[model samples]
Target: MRYDGSNELHARQARAKLEKLIKDKKIFDLTEKKPQRSIQANKYLHVCLSYFGCQIGETMEYVKRNYYKILCNPDTFIREREDKYLGRVKYLRSSSELDSSEFSLTVDRFRNWCSSNAGVYIPSPDEERLIQLMELEIERNKEFI
Candidate 1:
């Protein structure tokens, strides 16, 4: 989906510019005394890799192992992932005061709703409980998965 303030063309343009800078060594220049930039470089690479369909952890590992410029900035990788998923959806603005209670209730209702909607009542109570446990696990790990 497109973000409200950006389009594919703009993104492509930005990427192209970054590619040009990297190719020209402008981004890696360190002739004079310079502040450390390995972390920033790596984080930005992770963001780019993610947009190109790499998983966050995999992209992070690849950049860390291969890139001399980004070996230091671990926080950048995490923040990039956070920025991608949480884009434009700030928690302060999106969350309600009742969010904690509402979220738990929603999960419970969803579990019951799924069970009831199954074609037929499952014969074994243990089987039903297993299903509920699996569902809970799935719900809890949804974001990472």
Candidate 2:
């Protein structure tokens, strides 16, 4: 199935919700154990690597080669990837909010590239769980808020 506008819309909505939760400080209580920055970064990297059809070894190699660059300036890495793999889409803006069409195009291109180059399909479960876990965490912390 091709990525479409609806998918982009949904992703934006979910991202907005998460951002709102974060802004409201409703997702985590300071008194409790908080999610680690490394964990969050790893989860995000996993999702991005999955989109690119990078297996564990490939992902590790990518991190090894680009970790410092990513840490120092993530937008550069994102822009490089977009320029390399997604010519059809406009460059990603620094703003957190993404244009739906651009987002859809990025996803489509990544999936297509991954399938053709790596012979691997994107697995939905991990991405789904990642979002779900955030939502659940927010829900669980609602009372504290």
Candidate 3:
């Protein structure tokens, strides 16, 4: 059974059920949930991505789809075929599902991949000047959004 902890009442009910199950000696594994990436992390990631995309004369969407989504995290893509058309399709798992550490690793991989393969050195958020310039450039372009 899948347990959702978003709802207070449901979470309490699920905990009670789990306690009873434990008492009944049913084997189970329980793990604590990790925090997801913060808003600042997300913003920094996008800023770097948009900057790199602009440098390469590509749209942010194009860079995100090809470079970050496909390359850095290929495992998240699910392949399926349509029964009626028999055409293959792919669905990407949302990055929002990733925990803070997982998201940070993914971002690091993207940065490394960009530098090694694309020869584009994306500045870190710590490089405040470059980051601000990139943000301004993206704002001017409008397509970076």
Candidate 4:
């Protein structure tokens, strides 16, 4: 879920809750470190996603192109939240003030980039819906710009 909240307190509360979930290993399992055996990894790959530097499709491309690399060190494939918003948008403390009006445009651009240069056209049809999700995120952060 997006971490946008009404204020610092809300944000902190949300962060705490999310972090707690992480700490409790409810959101993601630590033992599932091996990408192949991990249901989360496969589910993550099977779904569309957008985070930081890599788009869902691009990530899939990276995995396709460098499966061995990812299998060798899964950390190399991990995407951080901060990397996604660094220069692209301003930091808004609350979700209410955010605007992602241009999210679709951004997604279109990223998709074009992915299709033309990233690799073979997203190999999996099941992934297109996941890529479309970038629109929501774009809308979520529209005001940040």
Candidate 5:
């Protein structure tokens, strides 16, 4: 159940319900559910990564892991796991977890970093040139899709 936290009456009603549940020994969990990243933004990210990969002579996965995530957006994707044989394992948080704005920020940081660090001039997602490039790539590489 959801109620507007800002509205006093709604908040009181939700609090009373939660209190009743607690008194009755009911178990529940709560979390905020934000909208996931946009499909268009995801497509732009892949296009940017693919172009950067071509420029740097590496695959998109390599570029995304080494350059984009590590260099541009450091310390944003840390995760941990426990294994029976290997003990504790630390890994990256998946990019899919980021909401639309966070993902866009990461992409922008990657482009800016590429320009300054690697001398690769990646266009911003909204640029007309980038759109053209995306369309051109899709038309040429139909098999990859």
Candidate 6:
């Protein structure tokens, strides 16, 4: 269920569809009034990353460290550096991009990554539900696109 990023149109369509699902789920209203970098925001990001296999094993501590850095100045450290620091191979999008898009792409990328890497790890039932929702949305809307 990995999104075909090579197909730009399909990728954009998938992203738009996921964005709508996220808003409908009220996953973290990034409305103008909301503080973009609050504790709540970090918690939301943390949960999302955790669900996407970013916090496996000892990666939680690394995620937390970079998460704080992202909270402070997302534009400074690029995604490449973040991946290196996390000891992962490009598992995350740039903090600047996430900040600029209000984390819309972050959600899409995480979903895409998880879908392609399924069976690598087993998520909890609760996490599975969230992933399924996203996957269902993608599958249902992708046809319409």
Clashes of each: 3, 0, 0, 7, 1, 0
Model 3 regions more than 4 Å off? 1-33, 76-89, 143-145
Candidate 5 residue-wise lDDT, 96-129, digit = tens: 9898778878888898998999998787766977
Point out the higher-scoring one by TM-score: 3 or 4.
3
Better of 2 and 4 by lDDT: 2
Predicted candidate 6 versus true structure: per-residue lDDT over 1-145, tens digit per residue: 3456679987898778779878788554322233245554455555544433332432433543454334333444435533536664433444433453555444444444444554333233257576565445434444332
TM-score: the better of candidates 5 and 6: 5
The most accurate candidate by TM-score is: 5
RMSD of model 4 against the true structure: 17.3
How many Å off is the CA of 39 in candidate 6? 4.4
Off by over 4 Å in 4: 1-46, 50-100, 122-145
Root-mean-square deviation of Cα positions for candidate 2 versus the true structure, in angstroms: 17.6
lDDT score at residue 53, model 6, on the 0-100 scale:
31
Q: Of the pair 1 and 2, which is ahead by lDDT?
A: 2
Clashing pairs in 3: none
TM-score of 3: 0.66
Tell me the tens digit of each residue's lDDT in model 1 across 1-145. Answer: 2222257886787667667888887843323222333543333333332321222233423433333123222222222224666665322211122233343343333234324653222112235564454445434544543
Clash pairs, candidate 4, are: 48-130, 52-84, 99-142, 99-143, 100-138, 100-139, 100-142
List TM-scores for all candidates, in order: 0.19, 0.30, 0.66, 0.22, 0.72, 0.31
lDDT (Cα atoms) of all candidates against the true structure: 0.36, 0.44, 0.79, 0.40, 0.79, 0.47
Clashing pairs in 6: none
How would you encode candidate 2's per-residue C-alpha lDDT over 8-98 as one tens digit per residue? 8865776676678898878543232222334454454345453332243344335323432233234433453345565654342341233
Give the residue spans of candidate 5 off by over 4 A: 1-4, 7-13, 79-88, 138-145
Top-down TM-score ranking: 5, 3, 6, 2, 4, 1
- Which parts of model 1 have CA positions greater than 4 angstroms off? 1-98, 119-145
